[model samples]
Target chain A: MRDKVVTAAEALAEVRDGALVAFNFWGPGTPLHLMRALQERGVKDLTICTNNYTLRADVLREQGAVDAAILLPQTRKIIVAFSGVQQEDSSASVEIARRVQEGTLEIENVSHGLFIERLHAGAMHLGGIYSPIGIGTSLENGKEKRVINGVEYLFQEPIVPDLGLINAAKADTLGNLVCHGTARAANPVIAMASRYTVAEVFEVVEPGGLDPDTIVIPASFVDRIVRIPDDDPYSRERRVEQTLRSVKYRLEKMAEAEAEAAQGGGA
Target chain B: MKEKLTEELVAMRAAKELVPGDYCNLGIGIPLNCAAYAAEGVLLESENGVLGYGPVHDRESLDENIERVDWDIADAGMRYLEYVPGMSFFDMLTSFAMIRSGRLISILGGLQVSEKGDAAIHSTSKDDIASKIGGSMDLSWGAKRLIVTMTHCSKDGSPKIVRELTMPVTTRGRVNLIVTDMAVIEVTSSGLVLKEFAPGWTPEEIQEQTEATLTIAPDVREMEF
Candidate 1:
């Protein structure tokens, strides 16, 4: 059994250079404190993996913590799927894209289906799995294709990170963790696939404090717990923007409708 | 039909029959207009995470503080949309899940439709491949009934309704209905059946705009609206 308590920076200090790190939560629910701690510890040459590139843009860059990042191509910048603007331009995508173009930030672009399949395969402890998701596309490069029963299957390699960072809303002293809504995307899989895992929780209580059924992430996968007393404003902001940007095109469509209606009425 | 396309859309809305609670999607270009006149109780689900949405609200009244997915200005039609957060590109998987789960009732989009019900929205050339297919593939295979909306004739007077799609298909055998400015064609196991045509357009004219041979319905009426 591992000890349950540690300072966020101390927990992050354990990450070695060139290790692959995966973080839970996209925006604020991410273990920002731990990320910040890692930055302050002067960690370098690390390969960071997450659904998105930046946690809180300000915090990540200010600390200059990340040496490199691995992400899907489509996941590179947050753009309104229709209009193509940086989701919140002032915050992250622009800078990250700039870095990517400058060759400072590396990317590993995977198709939407293939990425989840990779994680699911990693969680299952399976060897590279077979699927036709990337068969003839650009993603097929560096991949092997095999025919079974006259059907072709593309072989995608598994993704396993060295350290997993997650944000838990609640956890017991034994290191079992739980996440609020929308935090489950890559956290559970990352925790299971990583070599070591650390979590930042809003509250750390005695053993048995959290019900067994309520736990989204089990304690057996956790190695350290860091308590974050307050909610993250950036994460909240990301959630709100995500909701808005997703609908921005629909809104524009509405505006077009009103214009037509006005013209029809005038005629 | 001043702006031939816009007038055609209004006609399509009036002619097409919509069932209440049908999970429908309006694709990016042409189908986007369909949402404006969606009948009551018809929930509009966007790939970015909105369901049971209303029409777009006034931009002047927009909240500077509340932004969605990419932190852009969200419209009223977008309110009550759920947010799926994730690592770098993970939210996309969730969005595709919503599409591929066969939960989407109907999907509306623009395209060149083949007789096989294969719809192509990506591009006519291999050079344009990186233009982003978005959720088209997911929606094509996932939605129960896929509808393709486009002009019957291409700009050079070529046909979009083809015997075989010349472009790479987003999905195979996914299209159920094809609504054009001139008529409505449903792809059946046998071939293309002309379900409805606009008032005054002849079967020959419809066939002229189509590369495929069209079979006219005996009781075809001027597309209702």
Candidate 2:
């Protein structure tokens, strides 16, 4: 299958004003090439949805491309709980937290667990997903709550985005993409949940090149492919970059800790 | 390695322990220094991506504009930091899970290790009034083997080696070895066995700093580099 091969910057041409753009990066498999392109284009007032607010702060902040966002409540810097890690504060999540607190940015909170189920439902083209992920608590606001199997579940609507930015280890002309072990976290889910998906790969190969069993994302859903340079070892430099990215994040935590202390140590 | 903090880092170079394929997380403080002393082959996984980052460039070389991570640069021998394009907070959290899920082979840091190996890192919970658990919950709970590198006690002559935890905990019963400036204490079911002590310090001097009990080896030798 013949396909168009463009730089990540070019694929971002589809992004329009007020568009709800979603990124598929989960930290390790970020589509930085495409993010760079969007930064270069200088798009404005984007409505972004993702698992976290990190990429928007690190990349999109340069272009003022994001005005509002939909993300897991825990993805914000001062979160109480999130997927896998349980309850913890994230420096990357703090950047968005600062913006939200300053009123410079607007955010919509989704619980981490419900966020995944909603995206999964969207990928499956389901109308809605019902789960006990967020029920009977403050997160139940404005949502239809019902009892099923003697358990309470919240009716979470499907999440669909106008554009999806993704990263992959390799891709074929047919759009089949493969990711490294840990890099595959959310890219496939984000790919299926978006209308226009652009993939940035470490290597671009032929259509029949990738193994069928190893294909993490099928080309049928992808709209574009871009290449990003993989020059550095996954070592201290990455840690440094992570460090720089989290300075603001750590400061936010210190501030939160101070605030929490002032409030008599109650969450 | 020299006795000085920066010089002891030199020992990390000679020890040549961190392997190339290993996915390691450096705790804050001295362990962060380990990144600079890390052996050539290791891949240090930060909570964020952009691996192989050198230590911060000279202030003159810095952009002088944007805020950067505290220890955001590596040394000259350090490789170029690769940015794992598009990775997000959730992604790092998952990477941390990989650590918490027993995926990481080894973790290095310093601590007040309870006899059960429960690490109290957030704070003593009595001093400064406020203490919160960060990623320490995952790090101490995860990691195949936990290495605590620090002095054996607090500044006010308080022992880090305790029978029970009195402060907020990062993890419970996760410590494997305690690498201190004075000695290497291994936590056993009975209690802490002082495996080695600093060249100039004695078991009694070491105990003076600790509030808990200490057992000295009959043939104590200098700490291995």
- Candidate 1, residues B81-199: lDDT per residue as tens digits? 23333211223345556666777755455557888787776456543312244456556667867778777777777888887777756666778888877888888998889988776
Judge the docking of candidate 1 as incorrect, acceptable, medium or high. incorrect
Q: Which stretches of candidate 2 lie over 4 Å from their true place?
A: A1-29, A33-164, A178-198, A201-217, A220-267, B1-104, B120-139, B151-168, B217-220
Which CAPRI level is candidate 2? incorrect
* Global Cα lDDT for candidate 2: 0.57
Judging by TM-score against the true structure, name the best candidate: 1
Report RMSD (Å) for each prediction in the order shown: 7.6, 11.4
User: Compared with the true structure, what per-residue lDDT tens digits does model 2 show for residues A9-127?
Assistant: 67887677666666643445656556656756666666656554332343433333221232322122222212222123333345454566676555455543445556677878999
Go through the candidates in order and give each one's DockQ: 0.15, 0.04
lDDT of 2 at B78: 22
| Top DockQ hit | 1
Residues A1-267, model 1: lDDT tens digits: 557788777687677766777764343345666665665666566665555432223333343322122232213322111111133422445655566677665556444445555666776788988865444444466878899898667787776777788776788988888766444555666678777888877788998788897787788889888877455422434335443443464466579989999999899
